[model samples]
Target: MFHWLEKHPFFFAVGVFVTIAFAGLIEIVPNFAQASQPVIGTKPYTTLQLAGRHVYIKNSCNACHSQLIRPFKAETDRYGDYSLSGEYAFDRPFLWGSKRTGPDLHRVGNYRTTDWHENHMKDPVSVVPGSIMPGYPWLFENEADVETAYAEQLTVKNVFSVPYNTPLPMKDGSKVTVVLADTLSDAQASALEEAKLVAADMKDKSVQDAVAAGKIPEIVALIAYMNSLK
Candidate 1:
């Protein structure tokens, strides 16, 4: 069978191509016809959460940590439910990624606390002695250029929901305008608003704790974002 397939390589290749094309087209037809395409759930981030996501991305955390869990029996047994498609509604270019150097963080939200998170960030070894994770002390030292970088995040939210037009007021009183929605459906708007409020409360408490401790890092925002997973 191998020798005959090699001798007729072009024909075999063409046949394989045709079969794949037919399968691909069939799979996409339903997707294209759906009226309500899945919208990823996203809400405006509090300053801290936005900063955290930036930290996560800038550090190339994706290089080691995937945000997805497989639905196979073994994966479900190990990581809980197979990741829900709806759960990732807010992720763009979804982080349901390819590598697994550490572990699936789909539910890391419930696993640790702020102080514990800070220790891990400051020196992974202090928390997990055998951890291969790199410490992110730069997060402790660097002052994020809050105005310019965070403005871009508002732009993205505007694109997703027209009612997201409310501008975030910076501490300096400058307003960041968003273009997404003037009025989201009641449910969508409520959910987004609730998420923002919760994130804000978390940021305030985290920052207060850091200040009280005096050993705190500047990027409590990033920590809040990490804790928001799932």
Candidate 2:
């Protein structure tokens, strides 16, 4: 086979391409499989969180913030740990922003509380002095698209097998289950319940009223999404 192939330059090039392609596949396939698995303790987003994510996107939050934290001491000190692919297994169209105009928010949920996010979103300068970020007063007034978020949940659950409603392994050897609703009404109810919990920590009366009226405002959803970053 080698003697005949060496005699033909075109055939030799084709063989070389095939050999390289096979080697590339061999190297990539295993890592892709492992990286796509959910990291231990990495939970899927709840219904409200998904809605909040939509709010984040609609507001173009990704343009200023990044979700990825590099593996460096400076980055680790400021942000949290280095990012892992498995940790984003459940994130559909991950918010791994291309630039860091503000800061990495991959673990913002870990440090910031609901009240803090509420205050910050209302007025970024209120919480962080000299902040260039503008306030999002509109988020408190606008409604979130819970329907789209629910659709996303269903798609990821069915297509990616995200382990929704199934026990997922944790770092402490415990298993937690993330339930994806079977119906739109159920998803809406669950999202409202979650929004209420988030609203409980906020001091804004308007936001409180919105949740009371069975509505999920953009601010509520945005906070929920931020809180899920951890």
Clashes of 2: 1
Query: Model 1, 166-215: lDDT tens per residue?
Result: 65554366766434323324333432343343334443454445444432
lDDT of each model, Cα atoms only? 0.59, 0.90
Off by over 4 Å in 2: none
Lowest summed lDDT across 10 adjacent residues in model 2 is found at: 155-164
Task: Name every residue pair that clashes in candidate 2.
Answer: 52-221
lDDT of 2 by residue, 184-213 (tens): 999999999999999999999999999999
lDDT for model 2 comes to 0.90
